[model samples]
Target: MSKGLTRRSMIAGSAASVLAAPALAQELPDTVQIRESLSSTTRRNTASFRAIQWRAHFPNLRNGAILVDIDSRALHLWQEDGGYHVYPSSVPQSAEMTRKGRTRVVRKVVGPTWRPTPNMRRRNPEWPAVVEPGPNNPLGTHALYLSWTYYRIHGTHDTRKIGRRSSSGCIGLYNEHIAEVFGMTKIGTQVLLI
Candidate 1:
């Protein structure tokens, strides 16, 4: 071994250089590129996932609060004790299908059966009137029924729906996420869709 270097040192240095090479090869973005990306629609959409104060939307946590941001496709929950959680969600397919305002969780159902609304049936004449609780059920494994007749915060088996505007009117979360939310929420949990 040399006075200042050894086989171990050489091997470690070589490994460090190899690990750093890809990072070094990548060029840093210019100011213009950074500015353009910041202003892009994608950035605007993703920026919606940022944390929001519960007080801005809710008068009080009461039983708890669930805030669904339609534009950002995100759901936020604030428990009465100040616990906070956020999840990516699926919103209504279009503005016409969206119902915005305050509502409460009127019911919580596990292994929920789904029934299409009259309007849903009218829109898709071929669609089934009843869907039993199963993998094919649009409601997934859990649902929190809203005060509004046809609106719900539920789970979707179709994961691609989350973080996108793909629901008929309900807010949809991944099944596992919904199950977790289901356990956290109560029948009177406050909900606001905006």
Candidate 2:
């Protein structure tokens, strides 16, 4: 067989090129509609994730501030000293279940017990009325009770719930994240859900 320009070599090179064509063709989308769709999606996902200054939402960080961005599934906290931190969170499952505006962290509990609210019981008749503080507790390891009744910024054992809309009417964080927030927050910490 000839060393160069053989029919077998040409056929093999052609086959390899054919097999690689689809991979090489997978380039960035260029169509206007597709580009617009991707742009909108990226904006929707990232617009809320951008770091927000506390002044935009609060007059002062007296007792510290907690801003829950439901749309982004994130919680942003500003310590009284101007320290800022962001954490992924789980938000209420529906608009009706969401409450916007201001509230305070009126209470903080570690190893918090879980109780199905009257409305919750009505909605989930089979759910237990009380859940003692433990692994099965929905409030995870800590809870920050809001001024609004039945509303809390708490922890969840279900890690999958973070960065999602899974809660009935509360914001949820990872147990570890909540533990960190719990340590830094005060009873009078300002809380806002938006």
Candidate 3:
């Protein structure tokens, strides 16, 4: 055999061995045929699985709507009737404003600006009056502002803060997760904060 052919075959064999070990470790049953079929296509399958799980978990909501259960720390997206998804979230410290109300979505802005509110300014006098949206902004890549309130359900710069009591008063979610919700939601969609 040619030297190049031998090298290619060795690399291919090594790659196959590495890929096969994980499958051997799991030893999945035949009943897990769906997982087996998706083994090579995990990302798309996972996204779809999560989307279906969200719909099943939050069945009472209508399509193009959402229910943000702060107490449960979950965001539910209602796509088309009975179609939707859920994502874990981080909300404001209940000890702070302790607000518990609902409002309609006013807008969804990607890479939203972070303007310090009067209260924010008071709390941190050194904070900039207006911080343009970017990686450094407290609001991450997406911000879904609500009607009749200064509050927003937006992505957070501090991603690790998700699933915790971290924000000043606004709802915080993972950047990518908020982006998913942003696409499914629209202006005037009801956002119940309970």
By lDDT, the best candidate is: 2
Clashing pairs in 1: none
Q: Write the per-residue lDDT of candidate 2 for residues 15-58, one digit (tens) a residue.
A: 45544555324221211111122234332443346566788999
Clashes of each: 0, 0, 1
The residue ranges of model 2 lying beyond 4 angstroms of the native Cα positions read: 1-48
CA lDDT, every prediction? Answer: 0.80, 0.81, 0.65
Q: What is candidate 2's local distance difference test score?
A: 0.81
Error of 3 at 38 (Å): 20
Tens digits of per-residue lDDT for model 1, 1-194: 77889754664565455445553243222111111222244334444356677879989888999999888788888788776667778899999999999989999999999999999999899999899999999999999999999899999888778778899999998888899899999989999989
Give the per-residue Cα lDDT of candidate 1 at 113: 91
Please give, for residues 10-39, the per-residue lDDT of candidate 3 as tens digits: 645554564455532432221111122222
Could you give me the TM-score of model 3 versus the true structure?
Answer: 0.66
